[model samples]
Target: MSDQIKFIVDSLNKEPFKKNYNLITFDSLGPMQLLQVLNDVLAEIDPKQDVDIREEMPEQTAKRMLNLLGILKYKPPGNATDMSTFRQGLVIGSKPVIYPVLHWLLQKSNELKKRAYLARFLIKLEVPSEFLQDETVADTNKQDISAMEEEKDQLMKRVERLKKRVETVQNHQRMLKIARQLRVEKEREEFLAQQKQEQKNQVSTESLYSGSQK
Candidate 1:
C-alpha cells in the first residue's frame, strides 16, 4: 500500500483521546507536518537510512515543512514513534498561519510528485482545526479575486456604452431616411401642382386667341 494511504489509516485510528477524523485530508496538511510525520515513520521503518530532507525534497515540499514548523506548540518527543514516549500525540491544536501552505501542497501534490517522499519516509497524518485560515495567503487570493471582478465590471460597462452609441447611430440613420422620404413626397406634390397650373393657363390663352380670330 502507498505510504500516504497508510498514513491516512493511521491518522483515522487516532480516536478516543484525539479528534475523530473521517479521512486523511492530505491537501490540508502543510509540508512541515508532512515531513515530520514522514520522519517519524521513516525512523520506525528505516532508521538506518540517511536522507537529507532539504537536498532530496523539492522546494515546495521543503517550504511546506518549514511552514508547519511554525505551528508546533510543543515538539513531539525527540523520537516520536516510541509508544513508551508517553507524550500527547498532538504537538499543536491550531495553526492558522500554515493553512495556506498546507492547502497548496495538498492541491499540487500530484503535479509535484510529493508522493515520492513516501519512498524515503513513513508518516502518520494528523488532523488539526478545520477552519484555520492563513491570513496572508487568503488575503492575497481575495485581492486577486476582487481585482478580476472589478476588471470584468469595467469591461461590461464599456460594452454597454458601445451598445448605446451603436443604437444612437442607428436612430440617426432612421431619422435621415424618414426626412428623405418626406422631402421626396413634398417635391412630387409641388411638381404636380405646378404642371396643372401651367396646363390651365395654356388653355385660357388658346381660348382668348380663338375668340379674337372669330
Candidate 2:
C-alpha cells in the first residue's frame, strides 16, 4: 500500500476512535500481528463480526478473516490476486498482496461502520424531516425515485414477456399431449372393429360349411 493510504487509515484509527495500531510495520507484519489488526479493524466496523484467532491455527485464522471480509462485500484489489491471497500475504508475509487488502480495509472501516449504522437506523426510524428539508437532497431523492420507477417498469415488462413465452410453450405441450391420447384411443377403436369383422367372417364360413355337409 502507498504511504498516503496508510496515513489515512492510521489517522482514522488514531483520531475519533483512539485505536492503537502498528502502522509503521504494517507492510512487514507477521500472520499473528496481521490477524490482530484484522480483528480490531473488523470490530471497529461491526462488533458482531469479531474473530478469535487465539486458539486456531494460522491458516484457520486467515481463512476465517477472509470469510468476514467477504461478508462485508470486499473484493481483493487486483485482478491477479484473488481472495485466496490471504494465506500467502498474511501468513507468508507477501507485501504486494497483503498490504493492498489491509489498506482497503483500513480505508473502508469508517464508511462501513456508518453504512451499518444507517441501515439499522433506517429500519427503525423514518427519514428525518431535517434531511428532506434541504431542496438539493429532496430533488436528488425525487430523481432517484423516478429512475427506480422506470427500471421497475422495464423489469415488469420483461417478466410479462417471459410469462407469455412460457404460456405459449405450455399450450403447445398441452396440444401434443391431447394428440397422443387421441392417437391411442383411435388405435384401440380400430383394433376392436377389426376383431368384430373377423368374428363375423368365421361365423359365415361355418354356416357355409354346414350347408355343404348337409
Candidate 3:
C-alpha cells in the first residue's frame, strides 16, 4: 500500500473513539460528541466543507466517514508526489486529511529509519477488503433498483395512453351509430308523410269528378 493510505489507516485507528473502545460497537459517545469528532477529522481534510455531521444515528456517521475515505483513495486532491513535496502542498492549500497524517508518518519514518513502526501501524489498522467490496455491491444494487423502477413507471404511462386511445375509439364508434339511427328515423318520417299526402289528393279528385257529373 502507498504511504498516504497507510497514514489514513493509522489516523483512523488512533481516533479517540477507536482507541478507547471497539469500533464495531460504535456508541462510545453521544450524538453531538460524535458529530464533533467526525467534523474534527473532516476539518483536517477540507475545513470549508465541514458544515454538519450530526445524524439521526451513529451508523450514518460511520458510513459517511467510510465514504469520505473511499473518495480520498479514488480521487485524491492533487497529483501524487514524494512525501516532502506532498507536505509542502498541504501547507499551501487544504488537502485531504490523509496528506497531513502521512506527512507526520513520513517524518517519523525518517527520524527512526526503521520499518517496524510502519509495519505496526499497518497491522493496527487492518481494514478488511470485504468491507470495501460490500460497499461497492450495495451501490450497484441501489442503481439497479432505481433503473427498474424508472422502467416500470414508463410502462405504466404507456398503458395509460393505450387506454385513452381505446376509450376515444369506442366513443367515436358510439357517435357514428347514433348518427346512423337518427338519419334512418328522419327518412322513415318523410316517407310516411308523402304517402298520406298522396292518399288525400286522390280523395279530393274523386269528390270533384262526382260534383261535375251531378
Best by lDDT: 2
**Residues 160-202 of candidate 2: C-alpha lDDT, one tens digit per residue:** 9987886778577788789999999999999999999999999
In terms of lDDT, model 2 sits at 0.60
* Deviation in Å, model 1, residue 153 alpha carbon: 1.8
Choose 1 or 3, whichever is better by lDDT: 3
Better of 2 and 3 by lDDT: 2
List TM-scores for all candidates, in order: 0.24, 0.43, 0.24
Per-residue alpha-carbon lDDT of candidate 1 for residues 1-214, written as tens digits (9 for 90 to 100): 2444444544434532132433356445654554454443322333432254545434333233322322221122233343122111222312332232333333343443333333223222221222113333234334545666677679899999987886778577788789999999999999999999999999999999999999
Q: What lDDT would each prediction earn against the true structure?
A: 0.43, 0.60, 0.48
- Summed backbone clashes in each candidate are 5, 0, 0
Candidate 3, residue 7: the lDDT equals 48
Query: Please, what's the RMSD in Å of model 3?
Result: 29.0
Give the higher-TM-score candidate: 2 or 3: 2
Write down the TM-score for model 3.
0.24
